[model samples]
Structures are given as C-alpha cells and as structure tokens.
Target: MGATAIVTRFAPSPTGHLHLGHAHSALFAWRRAREAGGRFLLRIEDIDPLRCRPEFTEAILEDLAWLGLDWDGEVRVQSAHLPEYRRALDALAARGLLYPCFCTRADIAREIAAAASAPHGPDGPLYPGTCRRLSAAERAVRLAAGEAHALRLDMAAALALLPAPLSFAEGGTRIACDPAQFGDAVLARKDVPASYHLCVTHDDALQGITLVTRGADLRPATHLHRLLQHLMGWPEPAYAHHPLITDATGRRLAKRDRAATLRDLRAAGRSPAEVRALAGWPD
Candidate 1:
C-alpha cells in the first residue's frame, strides 16, 4: 500500500442480525475502498458482552459475503483487545482527565429530576457530575472497596489540555469540533470495560483507516471522537456519514424494529442482487 492509500472500514455491533441499514453502510464503505483500489476492513464491535453473541457475529460475516462484498484483511474483533482499551483509560487517568462515576441510571435520574436545570445532550440528559465532585480520598476508598463504577472523562480538563481547536475533514471541508457538549463522556464501566467512543477512535488509528462512513445519526459523535484522536495524537480520518435507509413509514431499518434481515430476504427467495438494490446499491 502506498502512503496515500484510502483505507475504510465497516464496523458493526453483533447484538442482532444485519438489516438493510447495516447492508447500506457496509456496501458504502466497501465500494469506497474497492473503487479507490484501497483496503476495506471488517470489525466486530462486541464490547457489550451481555448483548452481543458469537452467533450474531458469525451471521454478520455470512451476510456480508452473501452480499458480494469482500474485505481486505482479517476482521478485527473489539472484545479481543481489552488490554489496549484499558491502557487508554489508564493514560487518561494519569492526566487527571478521567474520574470514577459511581452513579447508576436510577441515581442519575433522581439527581436530574430533583435538579432545577439538567441540560440535554445528543443522547439525552447529560450526566449531572455528581461523582465528578468526589474527593480524592473518597474516590480511593470507594475504588478500594470494589464499588461498581464507570469511568467518565473530565470534559473540561480534557478540553483545557487541548493546545488549539479540533476539527476533522469531511468531503473536502473541515468541520470544527466541540466535545464539551457531551459532558464528561463515559470511557469505561463496570459491566463494559470500554465504550464505543473510545474503541472506535482507537481502532481507526490502529488500523490506519483514512475514511469513516456510517449513518448520519452518529455525526454528533464525531465531535467527541475528534477529541479522543487529538488527545491520543492519532491521525484524523475523513468522515462520510450517509443517510440511513428507512422503511415506507420513514422508520430507519434496525434489528430492534424487526426490519427484514438479509437472511430473511434470502429465505424468501430474494436474490442477492435484489437485496443489494433494496439496500440502495443497485450495481
């Protein structure tokens, strides 16, 4: 591969089967790499052990192959790289850019409900910073006691560490990033050691992916991802967020929505070509 090779990837969580939206995103990335004579990679994002199953991961690979999409390298599974994510968390902690968050969902909801003002973020109500105020001794005691907690980024501290404003390339334009709106984003938790934000950014840098193509819904997350790349000194990847594939009623195709899976269509006698067209890739 040359220095200017355009590497792209299609990373999907294995919580469920691949629907039309997944097909569209995968096809988009694969075409971008194949057309440019670059590399297209596959990654299984199975960080959430409780939700992700091996069977789903297997099904994803089969579906992609059946769709006539071929990738360039061995699929990178996120679960197999726990230590790498841990090191990232440790590095952030060393800089005092991370703190243990002991609040559970119920605790956070109660705090937000009782508060006079709780600002909202792209996902929902932002964290109220209850544990962000814990004293060093108190935090140490709780950590030593093995209390369940999640690691949250000290957003303000992280921003302060930045030498200048952050931005990323998108379709030949630079978009400025403001990660502060995420408000102390979670990096790791008791149940899940790493988060999507942390893992995606780390893997993109590790894999040398030059372009990131995904659904438009995740565009907001690019801001936080940019911050992580800047903090870790990772090369910034140009992003091309595509519009989601929706059904007749405008609902996006999703496994939770019981949208038609590729296998479902295949079983119903729909050929691969038909499915590709349905996924918005006629050719």
Candidate 2:
C-alpha cells in the first residue's frame, strides 16, 4: 500500500494437493510480483473449515518451497481472519448492497434450470431475487424464526448506484462485467463466516494484494470483486488471468487430476524443473 512496487499473493484453499493449474497461477503471480520488485505473499484460503486440511496446507508450503518460490512473511490464512470478513460484511450490509439469500442449492438449481431452459452461459443460473423482494418485515419474520439463509450481493442494487462499463484484463481479453452478465452472487455463506467472493475481495485489499493471477476460467468473477471493492472502499488491484493447463481432453487440470499433482510428480521422481515444465513454467 505504501512504497511497495506491488504485492501479490497465491491464496490456495488447501482442500487437495497442488496440481498443474495451481502451479501455473503460483508461478505467474510470483514472477509478476518479483519482476515489479514487489512483495510476494502466501495466503491459505482455509475458510471452508469443512474442506480445509492442515496436511494439504503443509503440502502446499512444501511444494511452493520446492518450486523455489518464497513469500514475504508467515502464511496468512483466511480462517484466522473471520473478524475481518464479518466487519466487511457488516459494512456492505449497512450500505444496502448485500441481501439475505434463503435459497438452498437444490432450490437455486431448479430456478437456474428453469432459466437456462431458455438460455444461459456456463456461469450458472440467474438468481431470481426470490429473497430479494422480501420485505423487511418478512425477512425479520423468517430470521426471528431462525431461518438459514446465505447473503448475496444485490446486482441490481449495486449496478444502479455504481459506475458502469466495468472491465478487467484477462490475458488479452478486456472482459467486462455487464449488469446482465452476472446475478446476485453469494457473499457470506449463510451461517458460515465468508464465501469466496466476499473473502477474496476483503483479503486482497486487507493483505495489500497488488496483482491477482488466477485461471482464465475465473475471468468473469473479476468484475464482482471489482464492484465489491468499490462498495467496501477497498482498493482494486491489477489482475492477470492465465490460461489453464489442461489435459489432452481439454479439461482443465484440478486437484483430482492425480497425474498432474505435485505429489504424484514427486513420487514419480520428477525434478523441480520437470514439475514446473509440466505447466510450461521455468524452474
């Protein structure tokens, strides 16, 4: 935030072993920050306590160290930062930018299927504001009775008050977030502290992330984070969405892609150079 050239972070949720796509993003962020004489940090997005495992987190640190990438300080984990997420959530809620979403996964899926029966992209269904239209009295009635509901940012409410023509750089694509392209994205997982969209925005700014490098598949989300930043009075950083390393089938490698995982490679006696080269990155 001060005189630092730039600050970038590789925040991997330690749910599984680091795979090819993870390596690409890590190298891209590490190189980008280093080239700019900036600080590179590591953050463990372990907010999903249900899925996060300490063993996987340790493996990530080991793999990154093996890859010759170093972070500036002790790793920052999102699970340790719930108070921060809560503070940001409260701030946004006070501003009327976020609303409660009572729809469950199945309910949402049905609504989405109905919408997509007409037409929709791979991003999933548009939230029909089933909860958005709920009056304050109605919401409180449900809340008083102990209803489980996640929080979602009101796209219409946010767009109406915020500036338009929002855009972000995706490799070379000037991907923009039109009001119609995205729906009310969940911010805080109901009952849970923070969702990915909310935490990423909060942590990126709080941790002073200068550049964000992730898979191109998440290109559409840059806009959501961008808008959230503005609403929360957080600074927006430069972003780089790298191409995902995929298999011969054109499927992007994931943690379940066992053959591409660092563990599998290491067990196969693959050197650091060879492992990085698998993602087309230099050792």
Candidate 3:
C-alpha cells in the first residue's frame, strides 16, 4: 500500500467468542480497505484484565482468519501500550482537563436518585459532577492517601480549550459535536488504568487510521472522540457508522444474549461463504 493509502481497522474486545455481529463488523472494515488497496489493521482491545482473556484474543484471530479476512501488519494489543495511555492522561491532567473521580457506582446512583431530575446522556444519566467539585487540597490528600479513584475529563474545561467548534466528516458531510453530553466522562477507570475512550482514540491516531468504521450504536461516542482528537492535535478520520445486525426478534445481537457464534455455526457445517452471507456480505 502507498503511504497515503486508506487505513481502516476492526478492533474487538476479547471478552467472548466471535459472534455473527463481530463477523459483520470485521467484514465491513476489511472490504473497505481491501477493495481500496489500503491497509486493514486488527487490534485486540484487551485492556480490561478482569474481563478479557488471552484465549479469547487467540480465538478472535482464528475466527477472522477462518472467515478469510487478512489484515496488514502485526495486530496491535492495547494492554501492551499502557505507557501511551498514561502519557495521554498525564497531558490532560497537567492542563486541568482531567480530575480524579472517587465515586463508586453506588455513590453515583444515590446522588442521581437524590436529584429531582437527573439529566440523561447516551450512556444513561450523566455524572452529577460529584468529584469535579473536590477541593485541590482534598484531592491531594486523597491522592496521598492512595484512595482508589478513576480519572474523569472536566468536560467544560476541555470544551473551553477548543479553538473552535468541533465537527467530524461522516459520509462526506460534517456533523457537529456535542461532547458535553457525556458529562465528566471517565478517561481512566478505577479497575483499569486506561478507559476505552482514551485508548481507542490514541490508537487510531497512532495507527494512522484514515477511516473509522463501526456500528451505529457507537456514533454518540464519536462526538467525544472528536474532542479528544482535537485536544491531542491528532488528525481527524472519516467515519462510517453501519447498521447493526439484529436477530429476528428485532433485538441487536450481543454476546450476553448467547448469539450464534461463528465456531458454533462452523460446527453446524456452515461454510465461509454461507457465514459471510449471514454476516450481510457475500463474496
């Protein structure tokens, strides 16, 4: 591929086996890059040690290869690049764009319940800014005490730093961004040092992904991602949000639902061509 060749990727979390929905997403990204004579990269998002397993990661590679999908370069693993995410969080922290959030799920729920009307965001009720109001001295005391905490973006502060309004290209059109909707979104989780938002945007920029292809369910996340890209001065990539494949019940396919996995389908005598067709792509 040329230096300017289009680059796309299919990043999957190895929390479970490869389902039909996973195949559809992989095929969508692979075809885009392969047909354009560009690069299709594979990334394993195994940052969460508690849920992700090495066996699942290996299974992902096996299933994709079995489905006749080939990618360029060695696969990028998020866990292997912890320092990079730490650098990102450090940069934001230095600028006062990030704050330590010590609130647990139970704490947040109680706070939201107390509020007469809690504002909702794409992810559900927005954070009540409980930790954002912490005094510098108190935050320092907690840090010195080693109290467990997650890092949250100061949404207002981050938006104020933008030189201009943020927007991104989608299907040759510009879509305005509203990142504040994710009030004080978490950048680093309590259990994991890095959050998906921080790692994904950082890796996409690091990998020079010129096109971001994923499910429409993540379109809301694109708004916050654009904000991160602007904050880090990373190049913007065109996005293509595709429709999610749903079961006959009109519910989206999900691993939690025990969706028909590729391995199971293969065991049932399904060929690659048949699986590809089932994934909404037939060669």
**Top of the candidates by lDDT:** 3
TM-score of 2: 0.91
Off by over 4 Å in 2: 1-4, 111-122, 169-175, 257-259
Note each model's CA RMSD in angstroms.
0.8, 2.4, 0.7
- Backbone collision count in every prediction? 0, 1, 0
**Model 1 spans > 4 angstroms off:** none
Worst 10 residues of 2 by lDDT: 116-125
TM per candidate: 0.99, 0.91, 0.99
lDDT of each: 0.94, 0.82, 0.96
lDDT of 2 at 41: 92
User: What is the per-residue lDDT of model 3 for residues 1-283, given as tens digits with 9 covering 90 to 100?
Assistant: 6888899999999999999999999999999999999999999999999999999999999999999999999999999999999999999899989999999999999999999999999999999999999999999999999999999999999999888899999998999999999989999999998999999999999999999999999999999999999999889999999999999999999999999999999999999999999999988
Q: How close to the true structure is residue 215 of candidate 2, measured as C-alpha lDDT?
A: 82
How high is the lDDT of residue 207 in model 3? Answer: 97
| Pairwise lDDT winner, candidates 1 and 3 | 3
TM-score, cand. 3 vs. native: 0.99
Output the lDDT of residue 173, model 3. Answer: 95
Report the lDDT of model 3 for residue 221: 98
lDDT of 1 by residue, 1-283 (tens): 6889899999999999998899999999999998898999999999999999999999999999999999987999999999999998899899899999999999999999999999888889999999999999999999999999999999999999889899888988999898988999999977999999999999999999999999999999999999999888889899999999999999888888899888899999999899999999998
